[model samples]
Target chain A: MTERGYAMPMRSQDTGRGAAVRSFLSKSPPAAGRSRLPKVLTGIEGFDLITMGGLPAGRPTLVCGGPGCGKTLFAMTCLVNGASQYGEPGVFMTFEENAEEVAANVASLGFDIAGLVAAKKLAVDYVRVERSEIEESGDYDLEGLFVRLDYAIKSIGAKRVVLDTLEALFSGLGNTAILRAELRRLFAWLKVRGVTAIITGERGDGALTRHGLEEYVSDCVILLDVVAHEQVVTRRLRVVKYRGSAHGTNEYPFLIDDQGISVLPITSAGLGHEIDEGIVSSGVPGLDAMLGHNGFYRGSSVLFSGGAGTGKTTFAGIFADAAARRGERCLYFAFEESPQQIVRNLRSTGIDLQPHIDAGLLRFEASRPSTYGYEMHLARMNRDIDAFDPEVVVVDPLSAFRGTPTEIHNTLMRMVDLLKARGVTALFTRLISTQELHSGTDQGISSLIDIWIVLTDLEIAGERTRGVHLVKARGMNHSSQVRQYQLWDGGIRVIAGAFSGHRKPSAAPVLIASGKPAAKPKKSAKKSRR
Target chain B: MNQSLDNDGAKPAGTAAHPRTHYNLRLYVAGQTAKSMAAIANLKALCEQHLVDQYSIEVIDLRENPQLAAGDQILAVPTLVRHLPPPLKRIIGDLSDSEKVLVGLDIRERAPS
Candidate 1:
């Protein structure tokens, strides 16, 4: 009673009394012909984007998932985020865990639940329904729960509510008919109360919830899945149904870590990014010479495909270094090599990536492709991209994604889309087996990129020479002839051969001998004849 | 509101029917609807048949005392809570299922010796 009395004017003060009266005046459900419902943003990453704004305000959103799939955490984060970020008061009523347990669990995520509770911004109430505690002897209804919930809500003037796992009612009260009827009433009552709520339920064998709570909460339903693909677990979220709004219907990958749940909703922001016509170099000495001497278009996707030891990594390193040298941030994702290994290997070519790293303009994220599922890698990449906000992103050797070709393509497409929307130039290096080079299909991502630079080895007289060929550069005049290049102490340089001349020199052997050796070849042949 | 049915105001304080014979029953209803009326009538008839003239029924309407619902842990409408006869018992429904209600309230059998 004391807490309830104390909370009466706090919510009014927070939202202002005048606004409350106006909201109460128009509290009826929208007209039948209305298609869109007002939404409340939870501020969860990618969630608002996928839902096309957020959850329908003043309505319940049912979140269903299997065990340990972050149902409770998702609901808690919504409340926490709503209260802290959106300035909306919330109440978390747990039928399963107590308030302290919920608070302690999310403490690592930097959510000060206790502080919010004390500030009257949030109210966490644990509704216990023990089978051994109460007896039902006559015709009765669950007026008790309604009263408690109402009290909690009014005390904090909460605009948001979370019922973490409503399955406890079924187990605790063993009367399905009564509980079912009461739950329906509770949902209706919550709607009447005009609070945006989240009701989490456990996944059933066939339906969304074991108790079929979906029947009662039909406004919005979101399903979470923890899919284990090849021993790597990936969490995916899909909006099953949003009653009156157009939402993203794809299964978006979400990550739950120290920052809580972050969903990677691809393209929900749409592809209408403002394009920049600026051009940036590829970091190679003569590589820009092929593209009408004007580097690549800014924010465009570039692909570097080549066989092993064809200096594809060297090309990616040079691009990243060049970007960093120009005072632009570069994020290099190395799947096959460690950061130290990339630094050491690129140093031998005299590209010197260490200064960029020291200047805080260059960041190298190295990991093994087998470390997690492909979706998990994409989720992590999305997170890192958002945090780093780099202007140029390089994924060295895109072939390292060990998933199926379709999965790799989808992931790369999503990655490029996100980067393009953010106006970040992307460079991907793909490894192609020597046998796959002649089949005319250059790695699987050639069609998805704006620029394709193919690197191959030309085996001439028992010597393998590296050749750089600009197969396609969209919207620019590009050379069609292969230019043989050699990696030296400084960098990859175009040899002073006949084909090195731009504009497709009259078809030659496309081979260049290393310096001083090919110059004295005739003299050596004469000596042998003597 | 909160009232007892067919009782003439307050009775004598010590008018215990016969110790265990006095049945103190509380029926929680949301309002005076058809279902609530049916539950009230059915409970009175069953009490008359079993504990005749010894039972007292109290009706608490949620419209009047919404806060009281939490005390008895009432989740379903038209719930009957047997307060007297030592151990408490609860039967939920409109009281249409007479046999189930009797079995649930342990009224089909005599009190334990």
Candidate 2:
């Protein structure tokens, strides 16, 4: 299998196609003898992977969705990408919005439709079909539309075409029989022209398209859906049917941002990440010693879960600071507080992150979880990671996100998988309620985590002391003893002994180098081990 | 016949007194098909019956000039567009029903004698 991983011939050899192909082909069994259809890659992120290659070549694909579900944007992205990235000129025939409206709508996405038009790489023809303006008298055919489309295609030598919402014709023309026959002919005509076309339709009540366009364009059907859960809107794409190819049947979450549409095919990453043998420190030397392996495995994911104010952020900040101290790039994603707040709060605990940030070794991204949906957050994070290429990533307090348990778990799992695949170490902090801490429910992402640390605020003899417990560390004989730790202006000091009982006084601390003991040791333990 | 003569007499006097409303019509067709020919003939007959010498028809074949179809936003073949009217109107199909075409173009018809 390892040999086959490298020996497999890649179906898409286009430059800048990115990891979608590599990750997809890594898990799928090789096609032995079956012939695969030729495809035109739509340069949208992760869309190609779900379709295996792309929309079937020289076939019309039906894209049906409800209002504001990004059906038109999806079609326009394909057309623009085909023209710009793939060097294939395209024609956009809009039956609803005019040419200027169509161009203006996608302008924010940075699609230079006007420039492409000026360069003769794209042609946009708006077909206005107003029922009020049109009066039907006798027999007529839709040959004029064909002529216009042909002219546009011939003028640019287009290989891609888009008819955005062909259902508008059904309302314009009352003769359903003639309209249906003409549409069937138009689809067949498009196929014969050898242009990969996208025909968008309004979603029907029960069917795929309002006008039943799925009946004519049977080659491929893609459904775009927008669902709102807890007032957070998420757009999803599903390959409803693909005639000649196997496609992902899952409803992959997609995002429409400034750069355009990007679908996150999270499950396609599978569990085939390469493991690293090296270990990274847990920031606090005492915590690293507690893990027995001296640290977490490189490229592994660590979860720090505890109730609110259990010093979860402090632990994450220390790990990030440690990573930056070693001259490694670290990205700190702060969800609960601002970057300045985190830096100032950590500064009070003797962790100065300003220097690392100034030295460009550390970067901070702070955004409230409600600013976007879960999928958008993932998409933005994916973009940031790609741009920064950090070695260590810190997502402080994943619990700030408001979603169902499964949503949070799935997002974290994907994030971990993404980091692992890139060989980047990730640390996530989650806030667990008091009940959940005793119940042992840690957001259900523990299986994906390589190391789990539970922080607790223990009241020992009327003294509220912080305790650090290593719940599980994969492939390591970690200490199971819950050790008490104290936070001081100097730094965190993991006292050199287990909390044997609630009444026991503090044990002596083995101070870190270049550190002073902020508190006097109540009693010295002779069993102190480094 | 008497009502038509009365309207024609009134039209010539109105034409002499002020500028006549010359009907400017354009018939869009593709490849001179049977429907296209029928539409052209029906449009000419309607113009002869309604406006005699006060109308002019320009037939544009999309097969010869497909680019022109986009200028007028034409999608269906055998379409008649009234260009000279204050409010432009479009009627698609072969123009078989003169009554619907007259109503669509807002043309006032003379009552039968």
Candidate 3:
């Protein structure tokens, strides 16, 4: 008999009543001092993180979702990832769609189903059952299905199996009583066989699965939902239950593009990543002087709050260029302007961003926030950041988030948390309201930020002149002076004399004492070995 | 008896004048299980009584040819399918109830009248 609730010592991470309830729901009763349960990595992005490794090893996981929710695709990707990445052979037995159709559907994903089959690493079987062809005149069990599945698994020595949409058996056989009992036995048999399995079921109203298969497969349960808000549809996955594991219980927004399924757990990141005390350039020597230090700490998030025409994006562009000039990578996420537009506009400030981009050191990701849902933008940003692995990230003008203060703060916090966890310095520019320059309502990230620089247009002597002030620079002594500044073609530099009652003509580029690049920080020689 | 003989002469005897009607039946089973064998025997007895020499029974075992199950839409075993005698019919289950089987195959009219 299969061991029920195989108790393992709970890890320190598995504390909390919610986790206990989840373990109980997943049917794994916590024994006082058991060891960690082994996990089978699905290799799907963000999925393994939320699953605390992957689905419980050698156990069945029921993936239930509504129509068009990409359940089959999720299962297929898991199988493929297992076979290709984890070196575990898988068997895909689909009851709803034929093997050929499934193969064709996932062809765009670049999954070589046929090649895997030919290599004996994967097997795809379409269990076809029809209601019209056969008449039942006697009591029967589903032994034929078991036989076929056994043959398929043994043919390839499969370690993973997927039964996609097994509800078709009910419609085909028209005998729920017998099928339900047999299904229970099948799940048990699968456990006995010791192959990690995924069983997809259609979501039912008021039930986890249409056929209540959730009752039988209780090791782990994942619910996939495609929710529509306004006109945008976002796919989300939540781990309803996970036995013998401490899983993230949040409804993570998932994306189904050419890539199969990527669950983006917003809370997957923690604030426990090691902190670095090393300071990096603010890109502007004057700003560095204002901070009374070399620059903001590496891995610390810097916020630049300014109104329109205060040159917020320009500041970010300069910072990005400076990082790139230091032979480090920087990523610029412009929500308001396209890459070319931002590049062209920043040229007015004499900031050469094109060369860094051309050199592949600076990458610009520009998109209108209105084009995608908030979570999609976050997911895409995370994906790009993961791929780019930049040392510095700049999000120009956080105001484009276009949400309530709390919502915007939450998003910014998550993004900053993610960046900080990766040990990457982040610079965010926000547009401050003109009425109140230092109001927290206008700039909610003041608490989460390590440095806050506010730019304003001070109307003095009947002329509008730009002013830059360091509002809050944590852990550093800085000048409290509201230094006057100018943004012109040459570059941006502070004008020392403020409120002098005399305004001079725009001066030529006064490059800060052209000293050799600040001595490089001491780090491991193999640092940044990608 | 004399009166019935005079009437039969006038009708030229029912069996001699009427052509034998054909009853084409097919039984689908997964394998040679006890229930499948019983269904076959039960169907044969019913056909002998009702269809006389006018019926032919075809038995299909799905175990040897599983792919054919999809072609015939076979989901359950021991299913009897009536193909001929116009208007096809089907009866599922063990076919233990001869009265229900006869009615399902539309052979009730062939009963002794």
Candidate 4:
């Protein structure tokens, strides 16, 4: 069994009306006390956290889902994890696929089923039943199945069992009356054997399982769903019922890659991360001066919202370059541009990131936002961030993610929470329309942001001028006056004076021409030219 | 019909007749329960009537050798498997319904009138 951190005692409020109704619906009392039910850790990432441990130990868990929702894969993962990670051996009794096919299916996920079988740590038994080949006479019982299962279990001394799609027997045999009785017996016998079991079932119209196997396996039930919103599919898992255990009841988005299924318990992370007061430079000296002579708070999330071509990516790149130059690892996520494009574009602004890339101080992960769903993108980013373990993280143009406003906000919040929990400083850029820029509405994620920097393009006297301003900086004093800045070849050069009187069309050309001399006042100013 | 004959003594006498389509049947049972005994009696009676001198019956008790259940893909007790036919077939139950048993064994049309 996997160790759990929050094995909460049974609450008194749970014994109220809701518990009574649930117990009546399940036709059993909620397993007596709040004494923690033993669980078998699945070893899938983020799954044990949500279940507080895993499936109820020495009992069957019904995993039901529609076709291709990864029911079999989930069961196989648990069984394989049990045999490999845990010392307990397992037996996979497949009714839908043969032993070789099951082995081959999970092989891509790095499970060596054949090797495990040969090592006596695992067993695979494929129960072949064809209705066309068998004729039913007067009376019969499924004792032969019991005998085969018993023999297989004893042969391997298995401590885990997976009956992948046991409902296939209903179609293979003409006797449902007997089959149902035998199924009940099988579950009872499984519990008696003291081995944790997983039984996969197809989703029915109204019930959890097509054959109503959920009624038999009352210990635990999980529902896997594949929902599509705007044509983007995301797999979700929910612990529908855990008789004696408290589990996360929310539908958690999960991912199935070569590494197998990993459920992202997004809501498990609260706003409880430890805060840091260390300061990090903004890479541009003038911008640093505007941020109270220091920079963003370490481990804080910074948001840069601006209109089109306002140099959001450039600023993000400069921040990443600065972090890398300080010998800290930085992970830069490019949503709209490729890594080569970013490196080349930043090179023109004198922020060459190729050297940092070569030195392994900065890593660029460029992907089209449409390439995956929002949850998938988050999961991939989470995996990358965990792998890289960067000190500073940058996500350029978060608005490129195509989703509803709420979805975008939720994804951003989770991303911010992820970085903050790791005590990593994060900078995220959002490309907003000109109207939203003026209104200061950043898709409702502003509250989660620590530092808000808005960059706008000022159309004055037929020349496009760039202006930068600080909207809010939590826990520190920041320059509030809107400052005019020019994107020079060296980098961003904040003009010496604030853009107070520079909004006039007549005053625009003087500032544009004096951009070279105006940047000379700052002591740490670079030799910049427009 | 010699209903008292054991499974070994129930082999077809004089195999020289009807050599091309000899019926070979294997009856799978958990033990000598009432259902198993009824299935065995029904199977022997039906064979004596339709497949006289052209059939052999082999009874396997799964209770004695449980591992043998997977070989024949047996799930239900009192199962009758036909092995000699080109396409194998299994009839599960007490075999009290001789009509379905004959049809299942592909011998209904060839039954001697």
Candidate 5:
């Protein structure tokens, strides 16, 4: 029991209601509450805001990650920092590293662990299990460790306890059965005593945590991981299980430096928002007129859900560039491609986002979802929202939000909350197969979306045709047509809708015909052979 | 870019302990229960083996000093700490096995010089 913050107080299960009714009721309204826990900041950036505060203060939080990742550092900095920054006493018990070893490792990252120990603000307990020196009796418990730890914790009145490498006891100790039982007992015991504890465990191969500590610690489990793509290292963290709180559910990239690890979420919290009156074209002239008043709201969430080769991201870049042209700051959270890859492709579409990137009007960030859980992704967005203060956030391919552990329904709900609260215009592109569309709940997030723009690929009689359709727009009178659209050298154009065709296009990138094929490209000498 | 790692390998070694007299014995227990009774028995056996020559066992069962739980860093039943020894060490569970108590609690028969 790691201090339950919210509770049913009665029921054991969900007896809510039918599908449609529940969907409407899902995601608790942003209600203000009276939770005044003197929460210590996680320093992992955006993490604090999403949880309304940080993880329930003064309790156990298990941070599990694979080897060579940032688990040990994350644990150390908290203690080193909580002691110095918040004036909270901390005790670090290491089953793997001694005081000296712990000190030197974190010293590079700028934590003065050695100094803290010497000053008596922090205590380090290195439990060594040397087989050469000690013989084992299977019937024994870890009372020796308890006493030593008790002494250390008391000496400093430690409000925080970090058992770095919680799995070490299982390997080095003589008994696993007894160790697991004691671990369970230890967590329960820590709660009654009231100390914020962080227990770091080695992630099991092919599993979340090696020892299955997730089943043990109930309050929260933050999974941190380093993703390697083409030799680039991006560290991420996610809240796997957060009891009684709304948290971001995306694998947001984090950075480790002298101040320790900080997770920067790209999701914008719509707080402290200032609306802009400027109505900029999406660089797709035909699609703009069909948008009734033309273009999107200053800080609204614009979603583009479609199949491949429908020019979804290409169109997104044009909007991003259009905003940059007006000198408004914009940040793009790309999940599918690196910024360089995006720049390379956008260049072909004749939209140059790079110059704006250099001019401080735009930024491009890339990450893999498998690196962390959903919360981490939200936190990472929050970090960027704070840093960039962009008037617009373009997350190309919103469908990628569905990554890892099978499903991410809760994550989308939290993300929606973050966007509304931040008041920053967000653009999310989703990938929904045509099959999923026929089955309503397959892509459940569509209804939650403020604006649903579906891009369709029409392969009528073997000649490829493209159409852009607006399914719905809440609070706005938008187009409801399967309008024809095409890509020329510069950008996109919507010609006219077959059923409900009303708007016509003018100027650059305008639609002239309902399903006009793309003009043949000026052949390059090398492409001539093909 | 392999760098030298530290933590267990660095610092002042902190293990060059000094010779001492009147070893301080602390027996840790949750409360005065049957398990504690067995711990006191096991501790007594350990004391008779090594510290009998120059020391005593002060049973600090947690039943008395509940506030002192974290001070000693107790996690489970029947722990023994040699606070008197310069380089203090700990051993948990019942102090039933005398040989383990000698090496773990570090009660070596003072090496004959």
Candidate 6:
């Protein structure tokens, strides 16, 4: 018997495409004579949103992760939440910990486990796999387990299923061979009966699932990891594989709290937001004059594309502070630094988000984009936008949204549409490659927006100079010449093009150490080399 | 809560005591094939062997006063109620299983409780 766990070959390598076709067919509405099929939501926040109405109705998905990274907790939370939140009853089968202990452990997390069970919204059966309990008797099958599950499901007519760490079947059962075969049969049985299932596995090094059941069941596979680097402990999720849909490969940071997990995406922070028409300064009077009679549309998207360290974030901080000074709300989602670090950096540029934070006018959200799936990141931003409700939404650099084009396009398009509809003046600073700018083509976003500002760093004859120029302003006439912009204590100062040495600066350089000349990002360099 | 029986105390009731006295039970109905007709026939068959009242029967046609079926548990057209003893035992169904109806209502052969 082949011991490969979850050994289903990738669809790309499948023989007749029969299974995919059949799976697709099965997903359509059942025959007209059939009654409605029940699908229970998986309680993980935003999970339902991404799967676009939750895991495909009744199919089983494997949530695999290393121990202590909250593997079982993830599965348990789904069952507990399903019953409590959605009124969809569920049954949890544990092959690892005993029932009482599992319940107690989760109780600390504030999940009303006992109440749920007493209400009969949930059923927990711990399959005892202890060493001395069973005799390795005759051709025994998992018929008993299935029978118990069937009875429990019928008792309350449960619609959700969770099998926690089925690894115990390796030892508790009479034979591994029978268990494996039965496992496949069990998934088939669940499909026929239509119960949305979540089966968990311990994280394994090289396989999709622990103990190798990865290929057998599960339409999706998610991984959770606790990354402790430099004393920062963060829990992040990466959609290792979502078989049927497009998912983000990046691991996104998430917070586990009394209300469960909340994933944060900073760029999506100010979306779905409404902005006040109230006037605020851009910290630059001349540029403001060149922009409309006021400064940049009150709630329009402003992009400042410049080469490295050209004060992109610094300029945004000043605008953010300007809004704060006027008592207008501003939310700065710094993808690269913590709010404190941002405040410290901003103070040097002459604006502070802290006092406003104290006054409750300005807020900051920061996270590495690599920590979560793209959609999750975007969804988290939408959530934050609702909570913050900022009039001025500033994303330090929009280039991060640029790395993954399809998602970036979708995410940005939705974001732009939302910002415009809400009338929240939005600011996005993008670092364009020198090549993209010099070649006389707008960086991708030029077509998607109403205003574009080209910020440049002129490094000539050894001196580094910076300039900001407005290329286009939608529905408004704006500055058309290259001008000098400086980050001073408390704000940015803008003047006609600098009167210093000129290197004829191009796009921004990728952040590098030593503050020495930063190397162009390899991707950009490759394009230039080509 | 009695230790001797599960809830509802499964007990046999309405058995015949006098061998000479036949319980003379009549299950009134319009005719056979109707639910009431079946109930009447089923009751008579059930009592024949089990009850000391190896009863006789009479059929009453109530398709005219269907109103009377409601007073009884006659939601269905056919219903069988043991009318011999003071209290009645009702069973609904075609006279499919004679023994089940008798056992269910505890129509026992004459035996003291």
lDDT of each: 0.75, 0.80, 0.74, 0.80, 0.65, 0.59
Tell me how each candidate scores on DockQ against the true complex.
Answer: 0.26, 0.79, 0.22, 0.74, 0.17, 0.01
Candidate 2 deviant stretches above 4 angstroms: A1-35, A355-361, A373-376, A489-491, A501-530, B1-19, B109-113
lDDT of 5 by residue, A17-94 (tens): 122112221222321223554455554444554454565777789999998888888887778767876688899988
Residue-level lDDT tens digits of model 1 in A1-530: 12122111112122322232223223212211144679887667667766766789999999999999989898988898889878899999888877889899999877899999999999887876676544444345676677668877887799999998778888877677777888998999999999999999999999999989999999999999999978989999999999988777999999887656778776453467678889987766457666664579999999988988999898899889879878998888888887778889988987788888777788776777887787777876776666566899999878888777788888888888878877889999988876887786554677779899888876765667677778788887877767777676566665434343333323222332344222233233223323
- What TM-score goes with each of the models? 0.76, 0.86, 0.79, 0.85, 0.56, 0.52
How should the candidates be ordered by TM-score, best one leading?
2, 4, 3, 1, 5, 6
Error of 4 at A352 (Å): 2.9
Clashing pairs in 4: none
The DockQ ranking, best first, is 2, 4, 1, 3, 5, 6
Q: Residue A471 in candidate 3 has what lDDT? A: 82
Where is model 3 chain A poorest over a 10-residue stretch in terms of lDDT? A1-10
Looking at candidate 6 chain A, the ten consecutive residues that score lowest on lDDT are A1-10
**Candidate 4's error at A157, in angstroms?**
2.5
What local lDDT does model 2 show for residue A510? Answer: 38
DockQ-superior candidate, 1 or 6: 1
Off by over 4 Å in 4: A1-35, A501-530, B1-20, B109-113
What DockQ would candidate 2 receive versus the native complex? Answer: 0.79
Report the C-alpha lDDT of model 4 over B2-109, residue by residue, as the tens digit.
333533224553332234588889999998899999999999988776687778999999989998898888988989999986678899999887767867887644
Question: Tens digits of per-residue lDDT for model 3 on A1-530?
Answer: 01101111111222332233233223212212233888887867777767766888899999999999989999999899889878999999888888899999888877899999999999988876666543444466665576567777887899999998789898877668888988998999999999999999999989999889999999999999988866767788999998877778898888776545667766767767678988888866667767777788899899888778888888898889879879998888888777777888888777778888877788877777766667777876775566566899999767887866776778888898778877899999887777656445755678889898989886766778888888889888887877777776655666443324355324423322223122122011113310
Ten residues in a row with the worst lDDT in model 5 chain A? Answer: A1-10
Per-model chain B TM-scores are: 0.75, 0.78, 0.74, 0.78, 0.68, 0.51
